[model samples]
Target: MFSKDVVRYHHGHDHDHDHCHEHTHTRGAEVENKDEKTLKILLLHWVNHNETHEEGFREWVEKAREIGKEETASHIEKAIEYMQKANEMLIEAKKHM
Candidate 1:
């Protein structure tokens, strides 16, 4: 569960008003140009975290193979494929920076 403070901070919520998008708020910006640098940093962090998860999934795949659980291994392989696609999408997004 997300706390009120987290909601206020991340969603740019103002207690004076009853509203929150909870995602993609630009409350901190005071100029025409949005903060691309911060967004890039966030994307890089996401990529790093996804890579870590991929490593864990790889371990699970190896363990499944060792235990002769091909079905489980195949599922992890599909997850890894999705992860790779996500990483590729992020890489494509970086090109805009």
Candidate 2:
């Protein structure tokens, strides 16, 4: 569950872009630009969320192997590896930010 302190902030760009960005703002003062700050928050959230999902996937992998689904389990393990790689990139991005 998301914390009550975090609130969703929908902000529209004044540029010619046709799409609007939806960002989350925690209850506090922000010195950074809105878009960059929200992006950093989102990246952290995604990393944590991915960790939870990876744990669930590992549990399923064990169950799959127990039921004689070795191939399926292998695929899920590969997916977990890919997710780790993606998270590494996200972390790097946040570092640059």
Candidate 3:
């Protein structure tokens, strides 16, 4: 049994936090602009890929720091830049779609 206040609290907000909920319910656009659905799917996939790459890069940087490896730190920095580029590309693609 749930309290009334609890139910009210859950339903009271009209904030943009509902975007996630809306996103789940909404279907992709039907019109084709370079195959919009496919492009959106690929962009989303690349976003995840870039995120994982960034995470791994961060982990590698942390491990290098722990080992006091300055040379490896520089290499990790370069890798981070590349990951950031990939992330930015994915973000731009999503915006266009």
Candidate 4:
């Protein structure tokens, strides 16, 4: 008789191994990285502060465009791009922190 039921294992899956890998790190060493620490703080700050900044930036850009201020709109657009990059970096830093 052919068994209709089948089991599948995906990446990082170990059928025979019932336990997960354990990671160890030195105390204070991980947290002492200035860049990483700064990133974590920035991430948290952004999570709270980004909403206002993003909304204002969007509104300003839209208004600028509506008024046919192409130069100002372009500048605001560039600033938005930079803020996006900064936000992304903070996110990545949080992952490491």
Candidate 5:
């Protein structure tokens, strides 16, 4: 499963996690769209956030390859591609705004 899914599952049902601060993104559209300015800010934020994950996933891909997990590495590569596509779409949306 994806990291976000694991995060949501852990945080949504279990309250024993170490983190305390609220994640505003989890609230979705209602919380994100206060105005166009706020939405633009969130778009930039999400793009940066996804880039961080993509970097980490790339690192894990190398680690997986080292451990002879080529299949896992390939899957992570695919995930990186998806993240890039998402970022492109986000950038395009920002352009239109």
Candidate 6:
């Protein structure tokens, strides 16, 4: 039988566990990392934001093509590709959310 379950067995090994923190400091800036609940919301927001930008980028690509600006279209496509990478990252980050 294949049991897909998460059973927590604490054998006094507390040093090898993953947990999310509420805040983080970077470059002397105190940033609110937020807890799991907030993270889920933020992840969903980023997913929407990235998707919107991706669509806008594609539209720009089409506009560039319409004007026979092959170079601009190519650059916009590259930007779309980069936006896709960011989308992938945001999707993966949902694991923590």
TM-score of 4: 0.54
lDDT of 5 by residue, 16-44 (tens): 11232344555666454445656676688
Clash count of each predicted structure: 0, 0, 0, 0, 0, 0
Per-residue lDDT tens digits of candidate 2, residues 1-97?
Answer: 2233433335421212122254546644442566666687778877886787799899999999999999999999999999999999999989999
| Model 1 CA lDDT for position 14 | 28
Mind giving the per-residue lDDT tens digits that candidate 6 earns over 2-96? 22333354533222223344445563323443445557765776677667768878888899899999999999899888888887898898975
Give the runs in model 2 whose Cα sits over 4 Å from its true position: 1-32
On the 0 to 100 scale, the lDDT of residue 75 in model 6 is 93
Using lDDT, give the best candidate's number. 2
Comparing candidate 4 with candidate 5, which one achieves the higher lDDT?
5
Q: Rank by lDDT, highest first.
A: 2, 5, 1, 6, 3, 4
lDDT score, residue 96, model 6?
50
Model 4 residue 2 lDDT score:
20
- Reference-based TM-score, model 3: 0.56
| Total backbone clashes of candidate 6, pairs 3 or more residues apart or in separate chains | 0
**Candidate 5 Cα outliers beyond 4 Å, as residue runs:** 1-34
> lDDT per prediction?
0.71, 0.75, 0.64, 0.63, 0.73, 0.67
- Shift in Å, residue 62, candidate 5: 0.4
lDDT of 4 by residue, 1-97 (tens): 1223333445332222122133336657554564454556557766545555777888999899999998998998888888888878767767766
Give the winner by TM-score: 4 or 5: 5
Ranking by TM-score: 2, 5, 1, 6, 3, 4
Candidate 3 lDDT, 9-88, residue by residue in tens? 35353222111111233445533433565577667766775676678778888898899997897898898898788888
Candidate 6 lDDT (Cα, 0 to 1): 0.67
Model 1 / residue 39 / CA error / Å: 0.6
